[model samples]
Target: MRIALFVTCLNDALFPQAGIATVTVLERLGHTVAFPAAQSCCGQMHANTGYAAPARQLERLTEDAFAGQDAIVSPSGSCVAHLRAHTALPVYELSELLVDVLGVTDVGATFPHRVTYHPTCHGLRMLRLGDRPTALLRAVRGLDLVDLPEPEQCCGFGGTFALKNAAVSGAMLADKCASAASTGAEYLAAADNSCLAHIGGGLARHPGAPKPIHYAEILAATGGIRE
Candidate 1:
């Protein structure tokens, strides 16, 4: 498959590892992947913030990135979900495709510590990704997939909404972190880096709660870090 990597703006700046890990996972699976230079933000931030006009630019950029590709995949569920909500094609969530389409039960990554999943709003609600990530995590040899206290709650990092409403976002992060902490998981994993960044920023300010990690990192661990 000729796959294009959508290294989302947040992940490109804050968590390059997640994007790198995503490419690593896809390439390790014997698929061809491309990083289109024209790719930029998927415009979820603009769309969510009543700036749908600029989002069309994103659609243009993504359409360019997806040109002639067999499938388009990304580590960020929010972006993928946003596009899926708008268009129709073989675009897939990394976990959804990894488990359902790719048939990769074992990538050889080792995450011995227990971890809980925090599904982002657009990904969970819009994308409708249920427990497929957990199912794949449970299949890992030494992974301990702990139950998240509230599996369906938002991480309060609604892209630019977090900055637009920090107080409410903080409260939502507090609730999310408290629940994740209650699970005693070493990692708080999710599909979207944008929410993870907000949750992680909140956790950094809070007294407890582990920092958030991307599900792609776990999948990359199966093959271990490339660099």
Candidate 2:
């Protein structure tokens, strides 16, 4: 299958490894992956903040970026969920692609870490990716997957929501960090890095907190760093 990797702007700039890991996993599965240089933000920020015009324009550009690919896959569930709102093309978040389209779990990965999974709002609700990610995590040879308390709750990193409601965002994030820490896990794993960053930031203020790792990174692993 011809696949295009929609490395979202944040991943391209801030979390390049996640994108790379995504490609690594796909290639390992024997599918060719393409990187379209014209790809950019899915304009979710603009749309969520009441700027419809630019978001529409960006949505068009995103469609154009991956136009003609068999399937456009992204390491980010949030971005894929946003684009699916308007774009006609088939866009699959990594886990969705792996479990639904590719029909594979385990992906020949191993990460010997006690980990907890956080289902991001978009992936959990918009994509309805129930058990897909956890299934993959459980299939991993040495990874320990633990249930997150109130897994449906948002991580307070709803893009601009954190900026607009700083106090409320912080409180929500604090609760998320506490729940993640209570599991006694070495790493907090989630499909969306944005949520991880927010929750991880709160954990960072405290010593010895479980750092958040992108799930793609774990899936791409083959004896590399656990975190």
Candidate 3:
């Protein structure tokens, strides 16, 4: 499959490894991954923050970016959910593409670490990803997948919500961090780095917190080495 990777702005700027790991997993599966340089932010932030006009414009530009691809795949569920709602083009989150469209579970990965997954709101509520991510994790060669307490709880990183509702966001993040830490996992994985960034920022303040990681990075691992 010739897949166009929609590297979301957050991953492109701060979490490039997630994007790279996504491509790594796809190519390792014997599929061609294309990067459309014209792709930019899918305008999710703008739309969520009530700037509908600019959001619409950016959505159009994003649509044009991957105009003629077999499918558009993104590492971030938040952006994929936004684009899927706005555009007519086919957009799939990494897990969706791997499990539903491609009909493959084990991507020949090996990561020997205890890990827990936190389902982001967009992926859980909007995309309804369900167990696709966990199914893939379970297939990893040596990974120990632990159950996150309250796995469906939001991390309170609803884009601009973190900035606008600082106190509430912090309180929610503290609860999430506590839950993740309780699992005794070495890493906390999720599909959306936006939520990871928020949770990671909170986890970083404390010593001995589970390191935040994207699931793609785990899937891209070979011989127990993370990307």
Candidate 4:
């Protein structure tokens, strides 16, 4: 399969590892992963904040960036949700592509740490991808999937939410991080960097947080060990 990765701005800047892990896992699975140079933001921030005109302009640009591909895959479910709903192109969440579309599971990887998943607002409310990521995680060789206390809750980073409503966002993140910590999980992973970073900041503020991981990092565990 020829797959194109839409590395959103957040992943490119703050969480490049998720982008790397995404490429690593896809190539390891025998698919050609192309990082489109033209790809950029899907205008989610603008749309979420009620800035219609710029959001639509940016969305059109995003469509042009991902114009042709067997399938466009994104590590962030929020972005993928945008493509899935607002754009005409076929889009897939990384986990949904691996577990549902491609029919490839058990990624031949091992992650021996207990981990919980944080479903971001866009992924859960926008995409409604229930149990799909969890199912894929469970199929990994040595993964121990734990039930997040409130798996469906948002971590409160709605793109600009953390910056705009720091106090409210921080409080919500505290609750999410506390839930992840209570699970005794080594990692609190999610598909969205915006949320993961918000939760991670809360962890950094607190004494001992499990620290959030991008789901792709766990999926790409073996170093691709390189060919």
Steric collisions counted per model: 3, 0, 0, 0
Each model's RMSD to truth, in Å?
A: 2.1, 1.2, 0.9, 2.2
CA RMSD (A), model 2: 1.2
Q: What is candidate 4's CA lDDT for residue 42?
A: 89
Misplaced by over 4 Å in model 3 are none
Worst 10 residues of 2 by lDDT: 218-227
Candidate 2 has a TM-score of 0.97
> Predictions ranked by lDDT, top down?
3, 2, 4, 1
lDDT of 4 by residue, 1-227 (tens): 66898888889988888888888888888888888798778887788889989989888988888777878888999888876777897788888888777888767677877788887777788777787888878876777888889878778777776788989987888788789888888788888887887788888776666867888888888532211
- Per-residue C-alpha lDDT of model 2 across residues 1-227, encoded as one tens digit per residue: 88999999888889888999999999999999999989888998889889999999999999888889989999889888888887898999998899999999979998888889999999889989999999998988788888888888898989888999999998899888888888888888999888888998898987777888999999998774732
lDDT of 4 at 122: 78
- Please list the C-alpha lDDT of all candidates, in the order they appear: 0.78, 0.89, 0.93, 0.81
Instruction: For model 4, name the residue pairs that clash.
Output: none
lDDT score of residue 49 within candidate 1: 78
lDDT of 3 by residue, 172-194 (tens): 99999999999999999999998
What value does the lDDT take at residue 190 in candidate 4?
Answer: 88
Q: Candidate 1: misplaced stretches above 4 Å? A: 206-208, 222-227
Error of 1 at 119 (Å): 1.4
